[model samples]
Each structure stands twice: as C-alpha cells, then as structure tokens.
Target: MLEVGSTLPEVSFGYIKDGKMTDPRTNEIFGDKRVVVFAVPGAFTPTCSQAHLPGYVALADKIKAKGVDTIVCLSVNDAYVMDAWGKASNAEEIMMLADGNGFFTKSIGMDMNTSDFGGTRSVRYSMLVEDGEVVKIFVEDPGRFEVSDAETMLKNL
Candidate 1:
C-alpha cells in the first residue's frame, strides 16, 4: 500500500459537468498543493455516509486552516453517484472524485475484496499529500473506523 513519501499514481477521474464527461488528471488536481484525500468502500454505504465523509465535511475548515489546499473524497463509484452523495451530505467543502474502475485504489494497493460486500472495493483510508507526495497516511482496519477518522487527522495536522 502507498505510505508516507510515496508519490500518487497518475490516475484520471471521470466527472460530469454540464452534461459532458470530464476526465481530470490526478496531477492537475493535486500537484503542488496540500491535499487531503479520504477513501471509502462505497459512496452510500452506512459508515461512509454516516461518519467518514461527514466528519471530513464538518472539519474541512479546520483542516484547511492547517494549510490544506484541497479536501477530496474519493470512491470507486461513478461520478453521478458521487455527485449525488456530495449534495446530500452537504459536502461543498470537499471535492468528490470518482474512480469508476477502481484504477486509483488498485494502483495504490489500497484495493480489497470483501466477499460479504459482494465485490472488490477500496479499503477505508486517508492521506495527507503534499506536492504529489504522501506525508501522512491513515489506513483503517477491516470493519473499523479508528485511525482514519477526520478528528485524528486534524489532531495530527
């Protein structure tokens, strides 16, 4: 899995803006910036919707106060789903990034197969990336939401 000092892979996210598909390059979004990226297994899942993303949304101001330029919530779902979730969750302070095919998660070795969940998905994790390099990474254990919470990250920051 990616860790402190690892450079993020070149991944592209598919987004829909004005009824057109937009694939923004990873570097274009994170390059030369202090970005906080948190990953969840799914967009509408209980833990993710109830806590993970919401925690970040609530603390976005504080996080940015620490010099974070961007706050990204990335999932393996499509752009439409991600966008919808963002609106419902009041995530104006966060950027919703779609990894439609799990390319980004797999490339970073953060992919997992939870048979109970019925398919491949990303492991819940968050990272502090500065200038395209990882400086802090919080990876949650299976079925747990401990180290990866926003409060912990904010404290660390």
Candidate 2:
C-alpha cells in the first residue's frame, strides 16, 4: 500500500457531476490541496453502504473544517453507480470518484482479489493527502473496518 511520503499515482478517474461525466486526474484534485481520500471495496455493499460511506458523509463538514480541501469516497465501480450511491447517501459534500478499472487502486497497491465476492476490489483504506503526497494513511485489516473510519481520520486531523 502507498504509505506516508509517497506521492499519489498519476491516474484519472471519472465521476458524474451535474449530470455530466467528469474525469479528473489525481494531480488536478490533490495538487495544492489537503485532501482526505477513502477507498471502499465496492459501492452499495453492506459495510460500505451501512457504515463507511455514511460515516464520511456525516462527518464531511467537520473533516473539511480541519483544513481539508476535499473529502473523497472512492470505489472500484463505474461513474453511474458511484453517483447514485452518493446521492442515495446524501453525500453532497463528498466527492464520489469511480475507479472504473481498479487501476488507481492497483497503482497504490491497495487492490485485492476476491474470487467469490468481486473479481478485483480495493481494500478499505483512508489517507490524508497534501499537495499530492500522502501525509497519513490508515489501512484496515482484511474483512475489518476498525482503522479506516471517518471518526478516526477526523480525530487524527
């Protein structure tokens, strides 16, 4: 996994914004900004829908108050699904990014293989990125949601 002091990989991911598909590169979003990025295995899955994304959605304002320029929810899903999930969660303040092919997740060494579940998915993780470099990272253990919660990240900030 990408650790502290590692620069985020140069990758572009698409998302729906204002009814249009918007693809933004990592630099465009993380450069010159304090960004909090959290990745999930898939969208609308049990833990992610019930807790993970909701936690961030609920604490987004508080997280941003701590000098965070953006709070992003990333998943290895397509733009349409991501957009729908964000809307369903009432996550207007959070940026929902779709890593359609898991490229970004693989690039950061956070991708995991789930043969019976999903083909390839991202491991649950969160990071504090500033100016395109990771300042802090929290990666959850397999099948766990202990460390990468929004509350923990907020407390760290």
Candidate 3:
C-alpha cells in the first residue's frame, strides 16, 4: 500500500458540485493546493456516515485554518450517492469525491472488498497531500476506526 511520504497516484475522478458532474484532475482542482483526502469504504454505511465523515465535517474549519486548501472525502461510490450523502451529513466544507470504478483507490493500493458487501471498496484511510504528493497518512486496520479521525490529522498538521 502507498504510505506516508509517497507521491500520490495521478488519477481523475468525478464529483458533483452544484448538481453538475465535474472531473477533479482535468479541472486542476488540487494541482497547487494542499488538500486533505479521506477515503471510506462506502457511503451511507454505519461507521462512515455516523463517525468517519462527521469527524472531518466537524473539524473542517480547523483544518482549513491550518493552511489546508481543501478537505475532500473520497469513496468507491457513484457521484450521486456522494452528493446526497454530503448533503445529508451537512458537509458543506468538504468536497465529496466519487471513485466510482475504484480506479483511484486501486492506484493507491488501498482497494479491498468485504465478502458480505461484494465488491471493491476503498480502505478507511486519510492522507494529507500537497501539490499531489502525500505528506502524511492515517490508515486504519480493517474494521477498526481509531487512527484515521480528523483530530489526529489536525494534530499532525
């Protein structure tokens, strides 16, 4: 798996903004920006919906205050789902990115599958990327949720 200090993989993915579909890489979204990218297994799942994403949402301001250019939530789901979940969670400060085909997740070596769930999904992880290079990583153990919280990442900032 890609680790802290590794250069983040180059990949393009879709996101819904203002009800329109957009591509981040081609749009040059984070090319010169310092971004916080967090990935969850799926959208609207229990831990992800209730805890993982909310932590980032709650600390979005603090993270941005520390010079972060943006906070992004990535998941191996479609853009529509991400958009809906972002709205439902009240995550206005975070860009919910959709890795619909798992291409981005696989490129980072963080793709996995739960037998019960039945398909490829991103492992629970968080990264601080600056101009496309990973500066820090917080990868949680499978089914474990302690290491990748926003508070920890904030402290690292």
lDDT of 2 at 90: 97
How many collisions per candidate? 0, 0, 0
TM-score of each: 0.95, 0.98, 0.95
- What tens digits encode model 2's per-residue C-alpha lDDT throughout 1-157? 6999999999999989899999999999999999999999999999999999999998998999999999999999999999999999999999999999999999989999987988989999999999999999999999999999999999999
lDDT of each candidate versus the true structure: 0.90, 0.95, 0.89
Q: Lowest-scoring 10 consecutive residues by lDDT in candidate 2?
A: 111-120
**Candidate 3 residue spans exceeding 4 A from truth:** none
**lDDT by residue (tens digit), candidate 1, 48-128:** 999999999999999999999999999888999988999899998888889999899899999998668737789999999
Put down candidate 3 lDDT per residue, 1-157, tens digits, no spaces: 8876777667788899778998777236567889998899999999999999999999999999999999999999999999999999999999999989989899889999775784999999898888877889999998899988899999999
Number of the top lDDT candidate: 2
In candidate 1, residue 62 scores what lDDT?
99
